[model samples]
Target: MTASRPDIRTFLCRSDNIGVLLRDPATGACAAIDVPEAGPVLAALDETGWTLTDILVTHRHADHIDGIVEVKRRTGAKVTAPAKAGSAIPAVDVAVSEGDMVRVGSLTAVVWETPGHCADHVTYWFEGPRLIFAGDTLFTLGCGRVMEAEPAVLWRSLARFEGLPDETEVYSGHDYVLSNARFARAAEPDNARLVARMEEAERAKAEGRFLVPTTLGEERATNPFVRAAEPSLARSVDLAPGTEPERVFTALRAWKNKF
Candidate 1:
């Protein structure tokens, strides 16, 4: 029998952070990927009328876990966080590592240790639903900053997702698409797809639409950070065609830092 797909709700909190709610409709089991703040998360629960079952945290950043304590207190949700950094997060009940499975009602997510933005960062993937809660490791047109690791280390963390199905839906931690699209266009000015995507992103933001949950295929096509190894992308960024993907990736990230 096919597994049931989880319903997802995307909203903004702390200004630019993207908050996600995953619900198993069959059981009304709901989870919050990260609690940016309590008010929005609590309000979302109230709106959906689904009892919170779990809280999955990606890292130790203040914005990501600020609401965990309050949310847990209010709903008695179990908290799962990266094993390596479990001590830093408040009220963590389960410590998980790469390849571990987390169950939300009948839905299961495999954890991937993707540390680059921070040493404890991890992403959650629900294979049956083709959904990835990318956290801060990967974004629509960019990747997270290399805060606790070298550039190449971060690139390798990102490369882990390359094997996923092209149609996989990716939900990132931030709504940085508009700025990322600008840098992407500059890095590959002649790429028509990036140009068009930038235009579309502008309109979306202008209309107050949130652009989370982009497909992996779309990222592969338009995200310079994801396409670093492509010969055309390397050439656009003034790198040798045969340059190592890691090198290309590092250069692209450095450029984005300044862009």
Candidate 2:
């Protein structure tokens, strides 16, 4: 007898780092979000007894895609990467662009080209589950470093996410929860919500649990980079109420780059 289609199981591939695994339980077929290391990914698969079927890459950063070849060798999974990032990822079977729909078994994950952390950075959003593989583009409490692009580009990309329903779940590619909480404190010390969340993050780490899949609403409220354009935050950056949103974005990003 044959198993049903799709039915993917999502798990946190966590170590000192983090990634996400999307497994189609029916067929034991799986896909991994940005892989930080081959070891953790392999372990995740071993635990589930699944075969890696595809790699949904978001960017070209080695930390995000370095395990590609190894994972592919172990499972013979096809690879899909951003059109602009295909060259960096070995053996890409499909080069997708923004607005493209990537099918993983019976599930459809939409591609979002979000550049700032890298010119070729992209993200994937699984529709039925409302889960986002945010790569370095978005994190629980913090965002990725503005390494290869301007702060403004990132700001716009983040704004696009703001329009998503508040209940949307976010799964980022790294485990910087505690560190990001610290910066959130500096950005809004008086925000009791931020402080409370920081304590929760500490607890999750101490208990060996993942503190991710934070809601779009929670990030909108406490994420400094996304809220950097607010008048209060702009004032802290020495900007007037009338300052251009992009300028505010720049100041907040500069602060984080050094913070």
All candidates' lDDT scores?
Answer: 0.91, 0.80
**Candidate 2 all-Cα RMSD:** 3.1
Compose the digit string of candidate 2's lDDT tens values, residues 25-144.
Answer: 555667888676788788878887777888988888787777888888888888899999757888789999989998777677889999988999888887676778888888888888
lDDT of 1: 0.91
- Pick out the ten consecutive residues of candidate 2 with the lowest summed lDDT: 2-11
Q: What pairs collide in candidate 2?
A: none
For residues 79-137, what per-residue lDDT tens digits would candidate 1 score against the true structure? 99999895789999999999999988888899999989999999999998999999999
Model 2 residue runs over 4 Å out of place are 1-16, 25-28
Model 1's number of clashes is 0
Error of 1 at 246 (Å): 0.4
